[model samples]
Structures are given as C-alpha cells and as structure tokens.
Target: MKKEPIIIGIESSCDDTGVSIIKNRNILSNIILHQEIHKKYGGVVPELASRLHDVNITKAVNKAIFSAKIRRHEIDAVAFTLGPGLIGPLLVGASFAKSFSIGLGVPLLTVNHVQAHILSHFIQDANLNKDYCPKFPFLGLIVSGGHTQIIKVNDFFKMKILGSTLDDSVGEAFDKIARMLGFYYPGGPMIEYFSQNGNNKKFTFSKPTVSGLDFSFSGFKSDVLQFIKNESRKDSFFIKKNLSDICASIQKIISEILLDKVKKAILKTGIFRIALSGGVSANHEIRRAFMALSKGNKKYEVFILKKKYTTDNGAMIAIVGSLKYKRNLFDSVHVSPYSKFKTF
Candidate 1:
C-alpha cells in the first residue's frame, strides 16, 4: 500500500498564526496563536498583525511539529495560504513556506484562503464521523470578515462563485455593530452570548434588498447605526437598557439574510447539500438557523464545520494541501502572495 503523504500547512492570513501537520485526511496537530493586541484598537491593525506573524510563525511551526510527533525531514509538502488576506501576513506565511519547502526538499502548495475554509469539512478526526462529510457538488457559503461568497463546489478543486457580497461582509457588519455596542474587537461571539438572554422580536431592523443570490449588508449596517444614533438621542441609556434585545434583533436579521440567499441558491441550482464556512460560520445563531432549516426539511442536508475550523486555521489549509498533493499540484518558490479573492 502507498504511504500517505505528510503535509505542513501554515496560515497567517490575519490576526491568527496557525500551523498544522496532517497525514492523509487525519490531522496530527493544529496550533493556532491569536493576537490579542488588536482588541484595544477595536479591529486588526494590519502592520501589527504582520509583525506579530513574523514573530510567531517559527514558534508555531515548531510547536505543531512537536505536537504532531514528526520530524521536519518527514514532511512531504509545505502548504500555506496565499491570498484573500492582509498582504503583510500572507507574505510572512508564504515566504516561510517557500523556505521550508526548499529546506525539506519537498513540493510547495499555495492554497486559497476561502477554499481552505470550505474544504475544512474534509479534515478527519477520531471524534468526527466520516458519514457527516458532504459529497461533491455542494453549495458552500463562506462568511468571513473579509469575504462573503456562495460557491458551488463540484470537486476538490473545482468551484464556481454563484454569488458574493457587493459591499461589506457579514462578519464586518457584526464586528462594527459589536464595537458600537461597546464590545471587544471580535464582537460576533459576544453578541451571540448576549443575544441568548434577549428576545429577537423585541426590535426590528430593515434587511437589505439585493437581486439573485447576491448579498448586501452595508444598508443593514447603516440602518443599525442610524437607529442607534436616533434612539440614543432620545434616551441616553437606550443602548444600555436594550443591549441584549438589540443584539438579538441584529443577529436574527443577519442570520435571516444569509439563510434567505442560501435558500435561493438551493432553489435555483436544485442542490440540497449546503455547507457553511469561514469565520462568521462560527456564529451561534447562524449555525442554529442552518440546523433548524435542515431539520425542518428533509431535502436539505447541512454541514456546519466545527467551531475550531470555522475561523482561519492551519488545519483547513492542510486539508486542502493534502487534496492538492494527491493530484500533483504544487507551487513554485517564486509564487507571490495576493490580497484579492480568488475561486479555486
């Protein structure tokens, strides 16, 4: 029998530095180091994020190898995220991956950040049942701070974008609203936590109108901002008193907007298999909504990634790398990092 190739994936797309080692479809080790310094700034500072990635990348790689119980020389390929992220951070990971590939005499793999997120479902683990994995030709809804896209995944590397955001991403809207509500930098989780105690119907926000499967969250964000400003003027403590309700209302509308488009995509394409990916996929409301949708209808089969894989992580990158390696797809050392989104 042929031995499975071992791949090391490096992800420094944004505030997190993630490193992972995988053999075949199983993850041996996945290490993620988050930059907490951005909390005070209310958002990721690109320069600081890059500098920190430079400082943390080596340590993360070493730790991942150690945790995976593998020697550096045993790696068959080095994979790293190449784009759709902050340029500085992407460069940090890409440069290291190139150097690592050369040092180990192995092939280098460049993975698209968004593709990794969607492929994360393929990552195998002892606790995950193989039956839960989605088959080919599934709809992938990627919701991250930087991107909002609905992709049709026909194969491991074959994907086509069906729709995308015209303005701000859903994750960005969550973060901005969370900051306005006095939450920390990554406000999605906080909003979820608080919304649990409030009623989603207590307040209402206008949803954006967009044609086809496309999404537009900028108008929704503006509606929230204007409502807050108008209400706060009337009652100085309005936000303080209705924080939970406000969170619930916004969360509901955001989740509805996403699901609405997803339903449209399903109806248009006649595909019932749906998978959620990217950072915003971690939103509790979003996950729950997808779960409810699947339960309410037998035709829809929903696959929600584990929370750990939902955000930017090396495990997702490594899984994509493993798939690409099987097909002999490798990148040259001269490959450069890009900041714009690309479909695989």
Candidate 2:
C-alpha cells in the first residue's frame, strides 16, 4: 500500500521562514522568506527575527501550497521544527502547524531541527535517498550559525551528542571574520569568494584544541582579531591589499580545524558512517575537506548535503516528520515552543 504522500513543513527556527511541500522523495514547492533586516545589526536580532517569521510564515506556506496546486485538506501530515531556535519564531511556526493540522484533521509530527538536517540528505542526495543509503548508527556533525555538535545517531529518534562548541559555532565565526575584514554583514560568502585569490601561507592562525572530541572556537576568534589589529599597526591598508589572502588563510585554517576534530571524533566513536549538515557545511572548502577525509576510507562513508539543503529549511523537518508518522510517532497539540531545548 502506498502512503498518503502530502506533508506540509513549516520552518521558523531562525531569521528565515520557510515552507515546503514534499510528496515522498520529490519536492513540490519550497518557499523561503529570508529577512535581511538585521544586516545593520551584524547579527540576528531575536525579536526582529521572530516578528519576521510571524509575518512571513503564512505567506510562505500559502505560496508553497498554492504553487504545488494542492489544497490544505490534501496535506496528510503536518511537520514543524520544535527546538534549538528562537522561541518566538519556533512558536509561531509550531503553533501554526498544530492548529493547521487540527483544522485539516491530519496527524502532527514534531521534528528535531538538527535531525531534520541529516534527513535532508535523504532528500538532497539521490544516491543516498533512492539507491545507496547509510545503515543505522551513524555519526553526524551538525554545524550551524547558532549550534555546533558532533552526534552519534543510533537511530532516527535516538542520538547522543559527543561534542559541541563551548562558545561560538563555526558559521558564527565566519560571519564575524567577514565583518572584521570589512565586508557586508553576512560576510561569510563574500569572504569565501575573496579568499580564492589570497595566500593562506601569509598568516598563521591557531587551531583551538577542545577537551576530547568537543570543540571551542572562541579563542580562535580572538586570535583573528588580534592578528588584524597587529597587522594594521604596520600599514593602514594592511587589510585592504591583503584582504583576500587573510580571508583565504583564515578559511583554510578553520576548515582544517573542523576536519581534524571530526576525524578524531570518528576514531573515538568508531562510527564508520559520518554525515554533515548545517550552514557552515555549505562552504566549499569545508565540503572539500570532508570529501577528502572520506575518500578511500571504507571504514567511513561520508555524507554531504546539498548547499540548498544545508541552511535552515522546512523540507527537512517535513521529511523527518513523515517518517516518524509512519511509525506512529506524533506530538501533542499542547506542546509549546522552546528557546533552549537542548537534546542530542
């Protein structure tokens, strides 16, 4: 028997309010409304983000459903992001999902925002999704703007966090570094683009050694700051002429540091299958590094998510939710959103 295929996914976990429709493996419509309103602030303003999500969630969802040429009642299941995000934003999305599910008389599935990322591979990677997929009990590195974690995924619902950042996550550092280099607010991509022509050997950046497989990026961030300050003492245009090289060098160092720790975690956990998900994982340098780490190593088959799926989105949550629904896993309508709901 074929499963009832329509699932509506709502993502308001952060500044981006996304809605997507997934009928099994194919994506029918995915609409993302990203707020660049916080550009001047240099970081996401929680209140502003929540407000934007509230305003955009319905519009995005309507667009998704309409573009897919489907009615609300056609949606068999409703899926939503539950935690590890701004409470106001998550609540806006979560409550809407629950209410909509009730009105449509469909089952409700609650998806962990992080796990949605891994499940993203199930949608983005055709080889993994339709053909050769990883078996149970894998390792996943979940890196994003706000969170960084190395998790041991024993199953779909059960996993353990082996390591995480004590301070800033990798993507946050990228944005900060971009700002220090005098780029736009969301300077990560600009930094990566400029980094192409620069010399990584021009500067020496130190890697932070966290206890065990856990990580720390705060010290490395300070090192970058002090390095920039010291270089400015020699020349006013120190960052101007050397900006590309500085960005390149810093990006390379950061990528290497991440891969190194991930390798260590792989060995310690003895997990053969490893997957990466998050905004930072979209970085080409980091992706290349992860690919290099997985090559010819039969003990580990590394999973890489498509760049489009790496950032926060609704399809991932919907996919996770659909799978859980098939297993009779559902969340109550009485659930409320959480700001700091930590679970591995």
Distance from true position, residue 83, model 2, in Å?
0.8
lDDT of each: 0.91, 0.82
Model 1: residue 149 alpha-carbon error in angstroms: 0.8
Q: Which ten residues in a row have the lowest lDDT in candidate 1?
A: 124-133
| Clash-forming residue pairs, model 2 | none
Q: Mind giving the per-residue lDDT tens digits that candidate 2 earns over 302-328? A: 887767788898778777877787788
For model 1 the local lDDT of residue 217 reads 88
The parts of candidate 1 lying over 4 Å away from their true place are 125-130
- Which lDDT value does model 1 have at 128? 25
* Candidate 1 local lDDT, 1-344, one digit each (tens): 98899999999999999999999889999999999999998899999999999999999999999999999989999999998899999999998999889999999999999999889988874212235689889999999999999999999888999999999999898998888888998898899989999899999999898999899988999899999999999999999999999999999999999999999999999999998988898888898899999889988889987788888899999999999999999889998999988656
Candidate 2 regions exceeding 4 Å error are 124-131, 296-299
Residue 226, model 1: Cα distance from true site in angstroms? 1.3
